[model samples]
Target: MKAYIAIKYHINLENKELIEEISNALEVNKIKSCCIIRDKEEWGRKTFSVEELMSISFKEIEISDFIVVDLSEKGVGLGIEAGYAYAKGIPIITIAKEGKDISNTLKGISKKIYTYEESSDLVNYFKRLKETSIIHNSI
Candidate 1:
């Protein structure tokens, strides 16, 4: 099934190697994934109007069966995308570094919240998520 990964843009710009590891994990678990920052071709084009761009993004999130929100850092865009996915009836999985405080607002909307100390934590979680239907259908 298709999944959209909502992550901070800075993660892409700075720690791309880590993102690659995450991508590998997703692929190993049999999920087709897309990330806005990693897929520059999806949004790097010039001359697109704001409305058009938003529509494209919204469409992607809507098409995905589920969303994975990386709460490793504070991100306005990530929060908005996760909220949009939640509103659209898509299951959401939220993950952050151990000891980080995730807002209750986000917890209420997510099907599951994982606190990770390393990439392996996320990788293992994704592996499990793929093998079972743990999605919470309620809004």
Candidate 2:
């Protein structure tokens, strides 16, 4: 299935290990991802008009079957993407660091909510997702 990872872009850059762990896990399961967190050139420090950002967001959402929104930090942009995906009826897995205050307001709309203490936790989640066959086949 095609998936999107909605995460704190800046945090991922600072924590390369976090991105690597998640990417590797997804790769193991053969999941294709449109992960904006790593697309530095398109969404880096360079500022863009809201119209441009929204256009990219819309295209990503259109091609994705599910979204894994990492609320490790409360990212406004990620929140917007998650909300859009929720509105489109796409499945979402909202994740955060254990004890992190990810607002229930956002979690209420998610198909699943998970909290991790370590990177391995994320890998395990993906494994479980794959085992359950919840990642829908790509169109």
Candidate 3:
């Protein structure tokens, strides 16, 4: 299965370890992830217009089986991505830090919402889901 990772672009750069942890968890479950920031080289180093970026993101979402959105920090792009995925009938899984407040709209559209104290908690949750075949069945 493949998952589209939706996160605030700035946060992605600042929280590399957290992103890496999530990416590793998906990898462990054999789920490929597509995230623009990490895959920018594939699109070349040139700057893209906002429309160009959204076009690319929509295409990525089109091919993905599901979306995993990090709501640790809010961003308009994250909501747009989640909404687009939802409209496309792609499953959405949301994750946030333990104390973060998740938007009700986001929660309503998500198949699952996970809150973690540490990145490892996200890893273990994925591991558990894999063992139970929940990930396979859900998405």
Candidate 4:
């Protein structure tokens, strides 16, 4: 399975670590994950036009089994990605830090939402989901 991780382009250290943790958790479950920022770095690409980026992202979302979106911080691009994934009939797993306010529009499209105090909460949840075969069958 493959997951497209949608997150704010400009993130703090905490959010960065959270993305890393999420990636690690997905790896343990044998799920391949991708995101724009990481892909750009891996490709050694310095710049891309907005249209180019969106084209790439849309292609990635189209091929992914599901999407994992971090909504702790609001961003137009995040919403766009979630909306595109939803339109493509792809499952969305939304996550946010405890106490962060998420827009109703996002919640409406999410298959599951996790409000976590620690990143480990997400890791454990993914483990449980994999154990129950939810990730494989449902997603």
Q: In order, what lDDT does every prediction score?
A: 0.75, 0.74, 0.84, 0.83
Which consecutive 10 residues in model 1 have the weakest lDDT in total? 40-49
Per residue, candidate 4 scores C-alpha lDDT tens digits across 6-107 of 988653334566678878877887888997877764433456778998999999999999999988788899999999999988988898889999899999
TM-score of each: 0.84, 0.83, 0.89, 0.88
Could you give me the TM-score of model 4 versus the true structure?
A: 0.88
Scored by Cα lDDT, where does model 1 land? 0.75
Higher-scoring candidate on lDDT, 2 or 3: 3
Q: Encode model 1's per-residue lDDT on 1-139: one tens digit a residue.
A: 7778887665236756556666776787888788765664333343346576467678889878888887877778778898899888898888888898899999999898988888876667887776565742332
Q: Note each model's CA RMSD in angstroms.
A: 2.9, 2.9, 2.2, 2.3
In model 3, which residue pairs have backbone atoms overlapping below 3 Å?
A: none
State residue 69's C-alpha deviation in candidate 3, in Å: 0.4
Could you tell which candidate, 1 or 4, scores higher by lDDT? 4
Model 4, C-alpha of 63: deviation from truth (Å): 0.8
RMSD of 1: 2.9
| Residue pairs whose backbone atoms clash in candidate 4 | none
Q: Answer with 1 or 4, whichever has the higher TM-score.
A: 4
Candidate 2 global CA lDDT score: 0.74
